[model samples]
Target: MSLIPSESMRPHQENVIGSTQLQFDQGSQPRLRVVTHTAKSILVRFGIVGLARQWPSSQRQATILRYHSVSSAGDYRSPTISVHPEMFRRQMEFLSRHYDVLTLDELVSGLETGSLPPKAVAITFDDGYKDNATEALPILARYNLPATFFVTSDAVLGKSAFWTGWLHRAVSSASEETLRKASDSLIGGMSSVLSREKIYAALASQVDHAHGSKRQQRFLALSRAFHHMPPLSSPSDFMMDIDDLRALLSAGMTIGAHTATHKVLAGLPEDDAREELSRSKQELEQALVTPIVHFAYPNGHVASNVDDAAIRLTREAGYRSGGTSRRGAALVGTPTHNLPRQGINDALGFSGFVFKLEEARFSLLLRGS
Candidate 1:
């Protein structure tokens, strides 16, 4: 009953074929990538994004890039989520310089009509972080890239920090050494694991599996599980308010629903899932005075958050489109509610940034974490 797409049930052949070709292309370069560190990237650079250019017709590469928070590197920053303003600026500039920035509607139209321009991309942000309005928007406007924000209605309307924000703050309080040990202890002991990304993913998986205080307890326990760092409690640790969302709409940005409380729909019972979708869409429309047509799976990964049931609920709620956080090429032929996105983070650096924009390993290496 899971809403996430399965391998055998993958919705689109064109999307899969392009994804496979890129994986095969990148498959032979592990040693070369390890040796030069820059060799594969050099190919991506000179090849004019060989991933997109090499794709056959009916499989045009239209990547949907996913981001979470953008700020000046304080409480709002997460190891997996936040991107610095400078880096964001550079990224936007790079995208504008090389590619055509498309709106969600534009991407869908291209997908439906097969008229997608080469080097096409769409930008999106998750969690409705306030900094997205304050810090990220100015830069986005400066570059004039059309973007979409999928927000959790409860967080914004109630002005509360997301449960995960507290967890990140707790982990951030400890040194990397402490986090590694804690995760090893809690998550079945992996020797090579260092960062908290996998542990965080594990913690997030537990979120929607239970409800009410059980959920709160899980978050708080995870918050305290690390080196006992206090949770980051600043007001900045929340989604954009109504004013912020409306302003973005006024600025010509699109908005999407991320559920009522950012719950993982796959774990919820049918009625709960239905409420999360329909209610959040209603709330967004009422607040922003615009129809909410798109939805992003809370975690958007097959194993963690989404499943086929979630997809069915999404359609039940009447969203025009939905997507997963899994890394891969954004293909037009895929199911409208199951597009794949490449995750963007600071770790990718400018070259990694370029490679991601290149969508080089999208199907091979996309991670929601």
Candidate 2:
């Protein structure tokens, strides 16, 4: 799914499903939140639920919530990934009140020893967006909860929008007809429908499988093949700048490497993958003035995302743990490198979103947990 909008946005933007409320926090920053919105109401009015309401024991399980952007403007590709600040605050408040909001370091300890606080959960933000530094940080501070930021070194340095961001913008701007034709012409044969979103997804899937110049070459081809065509037009400082990142650490957030560039790892050759992983870890450590010990796979998963080779590289890179987008909580005996996480959409509203989160946590549909 698409996330942040410009090389500037994930690259996920979402529509406000119902009403919108804007409130200023202590810093006088305006945040968009849903206060008893439609999405929340229906989920409650209908009583549509099959999951347990009581908090599940986290004694042997740790939940890692993966978030991309918390902005007023969510990523157009996947709005769910980009949550508005007000909505984000509400969720943070709920988590603080209801669950044991532990830090990434604490979760790591739990993973090693197989013991955690009841209802333990850790929050994480990926891609190092400016909003994460500005908007999300304040709320995190308010709740005094700890989060780990898996930053793409390039984005953190404010170089340009990551390839994922560019891909989303180009595809989203294309006309339906253009999108269809583009999908048909996809370099790697696609097995999904010829929709624009599917086309972007299919191409993104292949990026991890590509190595060296082949990934860049195909990316450029797609950029040209798309409607507007070529070059990452996203403005500089679209992602978090170096100062913003340092400030985040100063405020107590842990930093981890997402990669030098936010590209899939499995597709890259062994040497290239190692460089992306180790280089990023080294760069982050040097820049942030801290030992970077964690790694989150770019497009982390078991499917078209991270693989055993990628995991091996992360281990070689000297990371303490790795996180994946796979649904479920990290339980005892779970591989530390292949830890599972639940991706939440704040647009789902408080009650609705919470139910879905708990459902994913306890349901067998996503995993045996």
Candidate 3:
């Protein structure tokens, strides 16, 4: 099932690996994406995947997997933020059996000590969904793996849905005509063929930076404008309550702050960004009775979601580490305040998931990490 090349092919193989790494690290143009995926497939076929996984340097690099919701809500859920319970269980089982699963604390400690185990991996969940408690916990417990849960204090405490969750529910339940109208209103026009993604993008663009009461006001206006749709479900249905977080803590998982209302800090004024970072840590510490040492920038995947000011403020607020949505495996000397994590979702099936773990590793290895 793996390619075994002769000695004559070694130089050519190195060339292939180098070129693929260059294309992957560059921008994701559609053509480059196709080429990169094809290159990955070719590498996997050539048994480079096995080499990447078993490479000794992999022991020195740690992969942190980021997740949002582990749920069975199916079509009622947003796939961008969820993995079905069964898929999640399988992924965890694979990690338990094949990977060296570490707690976030342990990963940080390893980075500090410059010694990480081979195949080191850490699991983390963001946005504090109720399913992280009711559904994801038992499976993780079954595998005896510890993960970090970065929670938005306001959503959990107020029992309100995260803005993305609210938008998902609205988009999921909206009729085509309603989507058309909302799209037209929000974006100043619309395509003839509307979609949930199109609508969600429109709404997210409108409110991703709105914070506090202003955020509520915008969402309320959206709801009022689309009043014909059925009322959205209770926030408890989407978000974890205080009890759920306590349950996570009781099960020996770590809690980290993800801002108070999940506002993108890089876009906010200095005072507002400070409040989002500091207040979340303070409130969650008070609520959970544990020092919140880690912070994940909301929408941290986007370059715009993180800035020098955001990183400076996170450190000034006393967070020991800050995780970003950036893709790559973290190695020793990777900055404590800007750890890059790969976002795992349902779209990456088990094979894709396995490949992702090594894809970045292969790139790093080629570049001599």
Candidate 4:
């Protein structure tokens, strides 16, 4: 028998006051009843009953999973952003077994038309890392799964930045003591009890300094002063090159713009934001010869410095969709331009990945709650 009415239901009255009563009057067996005199009790019961009626089904909603690097060794360091190559393969195997792996275009179209299939997922890689081509592509190809990449155009052509190369090196080389000292130097009067996690978070925040341009420079200066390190000859030391990008595109994978310089768009003036968005899209389109319709914010958090004006500008520039670092399922009817994606890092194994996907699906069913 149907548990809840098929149509969306609303309460008979708004601002319901006084002692409210609920009686499950329609049933073949003994019905349940609850009585509440307090408003909080009534509201709580109403929510519980409503949620009980709209519980998530075994059938899943469409989801898009995001990844950064795919490497076995380095992945362990950043468990939230990188996955080991073998683990990635296991994830693919699991998805193949249970879900229909859709391409980015297919997912976008499904979202537009409200015809997305159950248990559907799309895979995406961010930052255009070289390991993605060397490690991730082969695994995806073996599984016959199509994936999308959001590329930073400058990095593709070989530009070194302080953040990508220096910050990484700093964290990797610094003794725990050095990290604490560096943190104090950068953020003045910061706590000495900073853990490695807090240190990394502070470094990441600097990625938006100078509206994203000086991120590399800041890292280089800090690394040189603190660790006595020499500057890298090539900024692309930590990123994929143009050839790597082309190879991925040639292998039937998709590429989208991640901005020209990976700047946090919200911090810039409108003109600067427009330039960054438009230029990155133009550069990528010129390189790949494909319509660049997707964009990913450099840092997915909502920041006072990031310009929301840029997001609007991206839509105006003809992007069909964009991705955020937010954790949730991409609902079938959600706007393609502001979609949320779950990150697939080392912390998520085969089981954790499944749990996240299920969580996203359940969240979708409980929408408007």
List TM-score per model, in order.
Answer: 0.76, 0.76, 0.86, 0.76
**Best by the TM-score measure:** 3
Which is the leading candidate under lDDT?
3
Q: In candidate 4, what residue range of length 10 has the lowest lDDT sum?
A: 23-32
Q: What global local distance difference test value does model 2 have?
A: 0.70
How does each model score on lDDT? 0.71, 0.70, 0.78, 0.67
lDDT of 3 by residue, 154-243 (tens): 888874556677777777777777767777776665636656776677777778867668877777778775675444334535688888
Residue clash pairs of candidate 1: 2-307, 2-308, 2-309, 3-307, 3-308, 3-309, 4-306, 4-307, 4-308, 327-366
Local accuracy of candidate 1 as per-residue lDDT tens digits, 181-299: 66666566662554555556575566657676887776665656653543423333456788898889888999998988778888677998899999999988987789999999987
Q: Which candidate, 1 or 3, has the higher lDDT?
A: 3
Minimum summed lDDT over a 10-residue window in model 2 is located at: 2-11
- Root-mean-square deviation of every model: 8.3, 12.3, 4.5, 9.0
Candidate 4 accuracy as TM-score: 0.76
Candidate 4 displacement at residue 309 in angstroms: 2.2
Error of 4 at 341 (Å): 0.5
The whole-model C-alpha lDDT of candidate 1 against the native structure comes to 0.71
